[model samples]
Target: MQIEPMATATEPTRKIVQRDPARTRARILKAAIAEFSAKGYSGARTVQIATRAKSNIRMLYHYFGGKDALYVRVLEEVLLRLRAAELQLDFESMEPTDGILKMFDFIDTHFGARPELRRLLAFENMNQARHLNRSAVIRDAASPVLGHIANLLRRGEQAGVFRPGIDALHLYTAMVSLAYYSRAHAPTLSRIFGTDLLCHQWQADHHAQSHQMLLGFLSRPTTA
Candidate 1:
């Protein structure tokens, strides 16, 4: 018995296990974004999101309530990230023309980084009031960023920099439309245009041209 102590099968080695709730939540959020982006809120399913997240339905609900709640949370998170990025532009230091260009650059980068955001937003627009109401808390949170942009526009107008007659809100809407619509509808546009409208080179050129065009439209007129 003591002889060669029957080499006890080294107690099956055990791998250390670590639980990462935060990481799991992030994974769920990421999967939810893709799911909702692909199928609008009405069409999106919680089980699908959970499955994509490699998580269980019960865990998904526990973390984010039901589908509607999860959709709202996803939108809120997206808006928060967008606001943070937009806020980094130092409008106070930038000339109106330069600021407008900076905004275009910012939007271009944002869309590139999060194409799904545009898709998700397109879905939201299909049922504007319903989705907006569901995410009202996030919209409320966005007021500060909106106010900051409005203030910048006011200052630009007062300083005789930006065109005087354009409404800031309208201008903001136009800017957003320009940035989002092209990419969002790229496939359709490419088919109609008989070219790859979203090709890397095309997008780069289009972005620069669009930024220049907007800047030209917004800049103060030169008197003869």
Candidate 2:
């Protein structure tokens, strides 16, 4: 009698592997953000981002198509994240001046936490079309908040809390200028001031001073 292969009572079974696409995608995005922020769109390399994400370039392309598409996705994700955080603010509860102060505090803290974000945004400013074309969702999401902020300015003017004849658009641009310039040019400012302007202590002082300066300007009486 020819003996066939005998079945073992205790056979090891192969385990099924499951990959978390969401987690992997998030990791890729975060890595891409850092890469793009540092090197910008043209200089950024997919291999470096993949290595940082503990992934491979093939997967990155599979998820985001290519480098340009990946860059756009990263931009969209960051813009959405920032907008979501800002939208949660309880603007109605605070006085107009206090709301403006809070805005400064928010910018200082948020931008401080993510210097890379400012870098990426600065890069976008250099190539407006490349980034702006991918920013439709961001603009749509921001429209309501912008409108709300404009309304707040109108209310403040009417209440005599802010000076009359100050354009809301101008004021908004001014606030953004103060925040963006401080952080974006921190290195140059640090060299000029002979101190690190990006330090937490410096940022705190700057934030307070900026808020005071803006409030003072807004409260000034208009010339006849």
Model number with the top lDDT: 2
Quantify how close model 1 is to the true structure by its C-alpha RMSD in Å. Answer: 3.4
Task: Estimate candidate 1's alpha-carbon lDDT, on a 0 to 1 scale.
Answer: 0.80
lDDT of 1 by residue, 57-95 (tens): 988988888887888888888877888888887887877
lDDT of 2 by residue, 29-68 (tens): 9999999999999899999999999999999999999998
* Cα TM-score per model: 0.84, 0.88
Best TM-score goes to which candidate? 2
For candidate 2, give the lDDT of residue 98.
Answer: 78
**Model 2 regions lying over 4 Å from their true place:** 1-12, 220-224
lDDT of 2 at 197: 80
Full-model lDDT for every candidate? 0.80, 0.81
Worst 10 residues of 1 by lDDT: 1-10
